[model samples]
Target: MNTEVIWTFLSTQGADFALKVLGALAAWVVGRWLIGIVVALIGRALEAGKRVDATLIQYLKSIISVLLTLVLVLAILDIFGVHTTSFAALFAGAGLAIGAAWSGMLGNFAAGVFLQVLRPYKVGDFISAAGVTGTVKELGLFATTIVTPDNVLTVVGNNKVIADTIQNYSAEPYRRVDCVAKVANSVDAQDAIARLRPAIAAIPNVRTTPAPDIEILQFTPEGPLLCVRPYTHTDHYWQVYFDTHKAIVATFGAAGYPVPETPVAHRMVAAG
Candidate 1:
């Protein structure tokens, strides 16, 4: 209301509070920058070793970031005149409550640790876990990041991933690419198999050691369904899959094979 009162307020309470706020802001900015640098340095150091697992490096980065961020928060609280000791005591006292409230998160964290030790799947590996099939992008403190075949980024809880079955396509040196081909009922099954065997083997990246498998899987009303499976590295699965289908089409078309169509039966009911 008056200049003297305003000056008194500004000199005492207002100035101290404003200074604390600014100091807290400055600490937050600097702390975050330092945390980023530390995490980056750690990542580079681990990667430079060439023996360290990329998944483990990512997990370590996540943990270090969390711990540093927590420290930064405490420092900011101290800047505002909150005693760090008292705050830490309060946190310790509330540990049980926090654990109970965040049980799922804690479970995920524990699962992540087990995953690191067990090494079921690693970053860049294509795997199917917890119903998510994709290439593992990163294994974090509480979640596994997967980039799906369709380019979707999916995050799955580590707990769920560990609890469920995991199928790692890249674990083996080569994986089978399953493709099917249908020939007309009149077409010779053996001849179709003969044509496909060499054509599929000619595809780039297809393994010759095991050889491509071309066999009649089953019989449908249209024709005999041939299972055309090619073995290749998981990295070339899609290429071999698409090429197998194209080979079947070109080979059949060049051989003048008729298209297999589902035969529809027509019955006439007698009038009552």
Candidate 2:
């Protein structure tokens, strides 16, 4: 009689355990499908809004999915008679510890959010930040990736970018190309202006509305300094800058005009 009772008890316990296992499996499958549906709905809402950055939307969707999956996991654990309240409290404590330990990562994430909202610069914008200059390639939750003009790829922490000044070269419609030329005192100012002005004005991307400004700026120890200021649309700033110098060198060489030995410092800015 005792043996029969033991067998019956064992069968009941086994069946209960099997039911729990099946329930957990069902919850996992259904929960995962629901999470997918939720994520898709969120994506649709963000797409319709059109106010959020593309990269930020992707990051937010991933976070939402992770959070939902975590909740689903906890529910499944509860089916196994696990202590969920204590587990959640323990999870919160552990999260706090991790957050304190990885505070820099948290800061980067915050900065990334701020950057996305502020719209200081966007992907494909050439910018200088965090002591580096490059074209923005991607914006992530923790880091921003940029590709240098020379093709060097740099990954910078978003926190670092927030701490520095951001110079956006591509934000404006026009950029100024500042060229200084130290010509020999013997060169006639009018002649030099006449020669350089038209050459700069004739460049393909140089803006003609304001026209190119060429005049004698100041005299230094080297010789007479002529400022060759030209306005060009932002995209052609660099090319026009280098090409103008090349043309200057060629023009002076052909005219037998002397250039001073002193190096000229170039200062560029948004065109005035």
Which has the greatest lDDT?
1
lDDT of 1 by residue, 51-96 (tens): 5567778978998999899999998998877889987888787987
Model 2 score (lDDT): 0.85
- Scored by TM-score, the top model is 2
List, residue by residue over 72-104, the lDDT tens digit for candidate 2: 999999998998999899989999999999999
Off by over 4 Å in 1: 1-93, 264-272
| Alpha-carbon RMSD, candidate 1 | 9.7
Clashes of each: 0, 0
Worst 10 residues of 2 by lDDT: 263-272
TM-scores vs. true structure, each candidate: 0.66, 0.71
Go through the candidates in order and give each one's C-alpha lDDT. 0.91, 0.85
Residue 244 displacement in candidate 1 (angstroms): 0.5
